[model samples]
Target: MARSRWLPDQHGAWAMLTVPFLAGTFLAPHPGPAHAVLLAAWSAGYVALFHGQQWLRLRLRRASRRPAAARCHVRPGLVFAAVFLVLGIPLAVRHPWLLLAAAACGPFVAVNTLYARVNRERALPNGLAAVVPACGMLPVAGRLGGAGLPWAPAAACLLYFWGTVPYVKTMIRERRSAGYRRASAAYHAVAIVAATLLSPWLALPFAGYLARAVALPGRGVKVPVVGAVEIAGSAALLLTLLLVF
Candidate 1:
């Protein structure tokens, strides 16, 4: 049977969500088997729930003859599930029941994403901005173990929220402005500033790009050059974080 075109693309969403969460998890503290299970369970359940709600909403919208935006919600869920099942199962089994708290938190935040999408009428990008922090926090909480909330996870969430704000605002602004080609540039600027406030080692090079972007008005600067420099600098910083920190 052909799949309905209106069905949500959870796999893609999962893939996108995994990147920052995995990156933060790698940088943050580690977790044991029990915590791992809870994280897996929570992540899995969230994905399932997201798809279920999206399906229900699509049906209702279709029945009302409202135009449906092409769905991308399910994509991330599928991707997250694939990664978690493949990697998380072994760890979960070893720890047995350590991840319950993280599991509990995942659905709470995920429902917020869905509610924002349905009630507030947020677009996919906005929904993602709301969802990503919760996803990122899952592994961090798992690593912390127990139900104890820590300052670092809160800090990480705050940093992510701030980083996403300009990006989201720029996305909205660009819809109305022709001269908004520098949206990514603006995002990099905000990211650099936030990173500086939180972690200078990660922030300085990002700030350098922001400076270049600010200085290079109407210079027709090569985008590839800027992108290459950013990528190289980010790689170097990651290497430093691994080796030195």
Candidate 2:
């Protein structure tokens, strides 16, 4: 079966990835009404921009296949505008960050969508994925009257990176598997363990890593000093988390 480029795939994956970061940002100590508004606006705007690009790409691809130009849907833009209006109104009243976040959504979604479209063969870039959450953490930390780039968010990003390496390997191997139930179970288990050792919500790294493990199989991929690296990384992550929290 041919994949529906506009419906799901890389774009969808990136969208889902944002959830944990959003949760972490929101869960941080009182972010105030302004931050909340900013977060919501940012999320909504991201969805709109992503969907718009998908629609445009789908149309362009179709047009290339036909003798005549293809007609594209106008509804996407209209819907996005409506959504932005509804979500942006409240934020405009009190918090400017909300509008700033919303504004950021257009660029973020554009960059990710373009990358996914261009880099179909390769796995999503971890460094790129890390950027969003890091940015999200900034406003959130600031709202709490702390430095935006504090140790906590940095540790969280590092943990996310560590877990993601294994998870990406898994995802590549099991791309067509429908055994999400098993994957989800394993993910939750790792998340629980990490959270216990780290922070309750810090489990995102574990969950993200688990997803990569499911996607890419690493059963035989060997590293010369894997054990040492794991031990060192884990120790560092723990120490950082301990110091931050």
Candidate 3:
């Protein structure tokens, strides 16, 4: 939690904390203490999950061969998990429905664990696995904030990131392949078109996304520059969603 210039690797973490939690809270007619506590619990749980996963990774690498930092994460990871569990107990007592989110996360954690064991963290199955828990947070946010489950915003969040995975893959993981770049551009283009047809307001940020994906990927833009643009796009999305919905 150094909170230096935002790490590119933590995009999913930030998205999970921001989009659903803020949108759901904003959409609520009257948010109160329970919503606050639940959000805190959820955020802490995500921290725990992140560290715990890191610890697992280090442990696995240690088994294969001794590595520096292998022992460092275990205590911190467990501390976060303990804190998360403690926070959850009372929140669950206050809102029984929180159990449902817990149950949903079980399968997600399972999937993540399976992928991690195979060292397939960047694989499609792993990416989809990451997105599901973020989707689950939307409903939790809605429930805690005294709103009905927010399916529309949740779906919007899902579609936005679902498109993001392949687009990013083309930029970083599969940057060498012209074919993959074309495929990513086309996917973004289709997303923009579909979003426009569905709702022009909704498509505003996706239009920006399509532009960047098409224009910037093959060019030699730096990583931080790409991150800055993505941050702007995310701000555009947050603003658009706030104003329209």
Candidate 4:
């Protein structure tokens, strides 16, 4: 495949990967080269796995229609994935548990890939799986940075994004349903309140989420604006984590 073909089109997933990695690295009490290498290796492996699985699914679907063309696409993607995997091996070797964490996260990726294959990548399962790899970052950074796993912060991040699932549904698939919009708003509002009760500062992002869920939908917020808002919200969440915990 050409270099462009190796790149993924899913910009949202990229943000999801980057934010947590940075959070884990920066929030770690003492970040060092090991943390950097671990994050790099993990990210490389993640991209390889994602693209490889995508190509496999594409090939399978197209095999009956155009087997030869499918093979051509699969071969290059697999080769690219293999090259990336090889690059990560040396780093993964020194920290075997990092590999274990990746293995654990692999099932979630597989689940996501399967959903994508069936054209259900926006389902509830995808929202849940989106957080798995990110959660794994907590332990990796913690172990390397001498922070010993920042569970509280990790939980906050998890719940914050998890809330996005329902809220986003209201903006897209469930957009016409007042009930779902209400439900999404209610969930976010509750989350904000709960997070605030737990830690006043931690609720800031959720509050922003709540505000958007209530104010944006039915107000003609397009998909691109929605994405921009999400990215901005994620940044706010990352900043909150960096300062609070």
Candidate 5:
């Protein structure tokens, strides 16, 4: 209970948060200290937001409300929030324009906040809303490196992360929903075409993703295997983007 309440259980989020940032920074011709600082701020902000949202989700309930459950999340939430401000402020001061990038997430954050209040955080809409900020970090991090690269990686990140919303739904919450499986497969099919438009190299990873989307439903695939495929898919995207640029 202690560890579980403090950290997020969404395993896929780790990749979603880290990969785009890493890809963006490295893809830049001149990766620098600011990018590292942004990474720290970004990670801390995520941890903080997760804890905060969990507390709110638990607190907003009345019938099943547990004060103890709500209390457990407070310390970590505030601690990480403080750490984020510490890491984020100076960087923001140096680059005032960074505020614009952060502000771009406002609508998504509003969506997430509404869902959290209603205890629907696991819904597909909420999950996809969360992906926007994480993927948005890709371009923002790339910009921090102070060099211009092809926008292909940023576009690839958007397509890959957005597609994960439906694909993962077909594995978990919506696993038994045949409609979800179809939707996931269809999204992957469209993603393959979008990837091809971004770069012919990108189509390879999307094809692999599409193959998994088509083949892996209702076959009792293990949780770890699903995670492994996602990790591999993400790495494949990263590598393919590098090759494309």
Candidate 6:
């Protein structure tokens, strides 16, 4: 009944979860009712995955943490999984081919679960694993809307979301590591170039992304500020993608 146990704890995941879907849905040429169903399915799947990962982490990592904590997730996990299947099956019946995206994301989901079970869910690998599938959703949703994979926009989406992983690491997990700082900066630089090549229009927002990646890491800015900046960056990317493509 408590809210904490009912909701996902990854505050920033809210944006990561939706932007790609919106990007893909909006970019799709033949957007329809199925896309809405897909969104609901996708959301249920994400919440299910989140709780499932947490349950595995608590259940397998140690006995000292208490089984009750793990069990609390079981109900929510099952409920969401059922919801995902309910919303997903009809779309699969209609499209049949969209399952490919779900299948493709499976390995990454496994990686995330593995890291969670090992209590390393916050590690860079786990973060990247999460980013890949989340970004991959762009193409899936685009194709769902009859966009035919929308490669250019999808690549742009991947570029933006991928950089966030290492950038966030530089802010939180690897804040003191100069190596991470360099890596994050380098990634943003590459993202900017890639976005530019994809479309000259995308370069500006990515440049803004690069500036924040470079300037804010060691500045002791609050987490909320970091989150706000990321939110803005995501919004800019989504808007720019919509406008350009």
lDDT of each: 0.48, 0.47, 0.72, 0.74, 0.85, 0.87
Cα error of candidate 1 at position 240, Å: 6.8
Predicted structure 4: lDDT: 0.74
Against the true structure, what is each candidate's TM-score?
Answer: 0.50, 0.50, 0.88, 0.86, 0.95, 0.96
lDDT of 6 by residue, 69-100 (tens): 89899999999999999999988888888788
Q: Which is the leading candidate under TM-score? A: 6
Off by over 4 Å in 4: 1-4, 66-76
lDDT of 3 by residue, 121-224 (tens): 78877887788787668667777777888776777676677777776777777777788789778878887776665567888788778888888777777767
How should the candidates be ordered by lDDT, best one leading?
6, 5, 4, 3, 1, 2
Worst 10 residues of 2 by lDDT: 1-10
RMSD of each: 6.9, 10.1, 2.7, 2.5, 1.6, 1.3
Q: What's the count of clashing pairs in each model shown?
A: 19, 17, 0, 0, 0, 0
Model 6 segments beyond 4 Å from truth? none
Clashing pairs in 6: none
Better of 1 and 6 by lDDT: 6
The reply for model 2, stretches above 4 Å from the true place, is 1-28, 31-39, 64-73, 98-107, 116-123, 126-138, 141-151, 154-166, 173-244
Between candidates 2 and 5, the lDDT winner: 5
Task: Name the runs in model 3 displaced over 4 angstroms.
Answer: 1-9, 193-198
Cα error of candidate 5 at position 44, Å: 0.6
Q: Compared to the true structure, candidate 2 yields what TM-score?
A: 0.50
lDDT of model 1 at position 54: 60
